[model samples]
Target: MTAVALLLTALFLAPTGALAADKIVIGVPTSLNFLEGKEANNSVKLAVDEINKAGGVKVGGKMLPFVVESIDIRDAAPGVPVPEALLGIEKLILEKKPNALVVGPFRSEALLAGMDMLAKHKVPLLGTIAMSPKTEAKVASDPKYKYVFRVSLDAKYFVGYIAGVMGFLGKEFGFNKVFIMNQDVAWARATAGIMTKIFEGKLKWKVVGHETFPTGASDFAPALMKAKMAGAQVIMPVFDMPQSGILVKQWKAMKVPALMAGFISPLTGPGAWKTFDGKIGGALNAIFELGNIPSAKYPPSKKYYDAYQAKYGVPLEAGHGPAPSYASVYLLKAAIEKAGSLDPDAIVAALKATDAQGVMGHIKFSKGNQLIYGNDPQKEALGCFFQWTDDGKRLIVYPPAIAEGTIKLPAGMKAAK
Candidate 1:
């Protein structure tokens, strides 16, 4: 192994039990059982190492390096209660007293409840997951919640992007009828609802059926059958859990004719086709970071894509975990430097004024303490809608300016008549 690789491996694998002097502890309180959790931790560690090597953030006349301290909130998988996640974050904060946080609770319920603790403790956090619109409301309504920021796109923004793609499909294949399937969770349901309103109101598409499935529920046949029976042309599924694997496998096996699109965390990466045993073909996934499905229209995506592969020895996966969490770290660093101290409120102010290029593209915080997104890769942090081919290839087919190919249906499936 090269010297750089050895050094990175040491830092990544290093124990967080002890803290060195003049180091800023970046706490990661997320569910370790999920892919997003693991990737979030990995990406945060990678970014901290990169920043430390480059003469760490200067604050209060001292160079403060970054160290990662994480706790397993265990909410991404089923069975963990929201209260338990609340306690986990509380413990991570009281014990570690990290200068800042990243990749917080994986579920919206925990995030809503955890927001109180974060505000009470006055620890600034940059969350990459848990996209509930309520999060924005909380930040907007209360000044105490100003310490919290979502680096990843929220559900509303996600729905906006998906709605446009669905509209394009309506024009492309004459699709009209739609089916909405979402995990019984706040984030998924919100995304599904927002898309439904847009489809029915602005897009003039017919809504065939809308169903909510329990989290961790593996049987998707019932919904697929209903969608087919309703003569739906598009299947919009919002799932953040790993059950997406089951959903796609069932979709392919059952030969569902509708175009599957929306947010499926499991199918967000370049390796998704292989991950689901090549069953995800023809499914269009809405990614949180453009890098999740890497496009040539953006150079930063390529840089982050290659660096992740080199550091982790695998393609980046686990929803929008890696890239967003990686970017969040640099954001926190920049905020700290801009504030020139470890004061939480000052960091929050710096973050609000942030306008830096991330792993995807340009990033700036608009209203609601969320990153702004636009169609132009050169302008804002942009994401795309991509479809998978049968032989495991990802095609960037949306936002015409950055599109590499047109959306295609799975072989043997015909477009809506």
Candidate 2:
């Protein structure tokens, strides 16, 4: 009788034991474009490690461990031939079949490719970068692609920021006419189009000039000269990191006097500032600097910053792309645990129901597939306007409350005489 009882017990426990051994795999597709994506990938890995140390995710009366599998799609060398990174992402998705996907530090084109695979699989692809509204439109237009969502503010938000800054400058500083230069990418074009409508239609500011440049074009001398000749008070250049830095440096060299400001990648960091120190004109950023603040109203920034610096031995910067990526892991874990199951549908439901406090703020999803804080609609996702100090520190100048100090205009950015 005892032997028979023990055999029954082992049989009953076998499936649950195997389930305990099972791990939830999360896929992260870092962009091949810049270092921000790499940092985001690292942050996601760190969060996964921390969760595992805390005994993994608890669901369905079982504790299942989780692992983050990162795919480095960044181009490493000058010109080594290899499979296109987007195709590699498709292969990873098909092969590993992770439960969820977190993509990018701004690669709208690449993300557009990966979204096709994710939609086919019906897996959730939460984006930390690639904020084009067109990407949102793709999901909204198709009921079948409901699994796609973004935590970051859309491109329109960037346009709003630009318009707000321009309005402030025009009203306060008597800066009127403006020139807009944007990269030829989908995001840049979309953002620039919106800005033109706002400046021309709403503010009544004259659009002295507008131009589009190829994404990797090195020289901005010709474009800058045109804006200068047009007597524009502001020049808004929307492009990626390295190129944006190069553009600013070249603009200064050409002695372009326009107040230069636009969307810049957080990845530009201190290194980029070091190159264009005291040269970059008025600048506004979507991300707030974590290290500079003593205690943010949001709690997770400090905690995450401390843990990250302790582990990585470097002060976390606004451009450190991994901060939000790391937070995504925790956010997903909370959703899965709340749902009490590993089923993708259940997880998705819980994620949509998410009103949990996150590093940024209380992240809640709306029917429009937008993530915003429940506490404040205006304070949805973190963004700020910052300009470089003489000492190369990024000082928050807008929104008043979080200002490190007032914005110090660079030498050549004075009101047009």
Model number with the top TM-score: 1
The C-alpha lDDT values of all candidates are 0.83, 0.67
Give a tens-digit lDDT track for model 2, residues 5-80: 9988877876322344378889886663456666667677778889999999997777888887777666332342
Query: Which residue runs does candidate 1 get wrong by more than 4 Å?
Result: 1-21, 216-226, 241-243, 253-255, 412-417
Q: TM-score for all predictions?
A: 0.87, 0.81
Decoy 1 TM-score against native? 0.87
Alpha-carbon RMSD, candidate 2:
4.8
Measured by TM-score, how close is model 2 to the native structure? 0.81
Candidate 2, 283: how far from true, in Å? Answer: 4.3
Worst 10 residues of 2 by lDDT: 286-295
Q: 138, model 1: CA deviation in Å?
A: 2.3
Candidate 1 — worst ten consecutive residues by lDDT sum?
A: 14-23
Q: Compute the lDDT of residue 122 as modeled in candidate 2.
A: 74
Per-residue lDDT value at 112 in model 1? 91
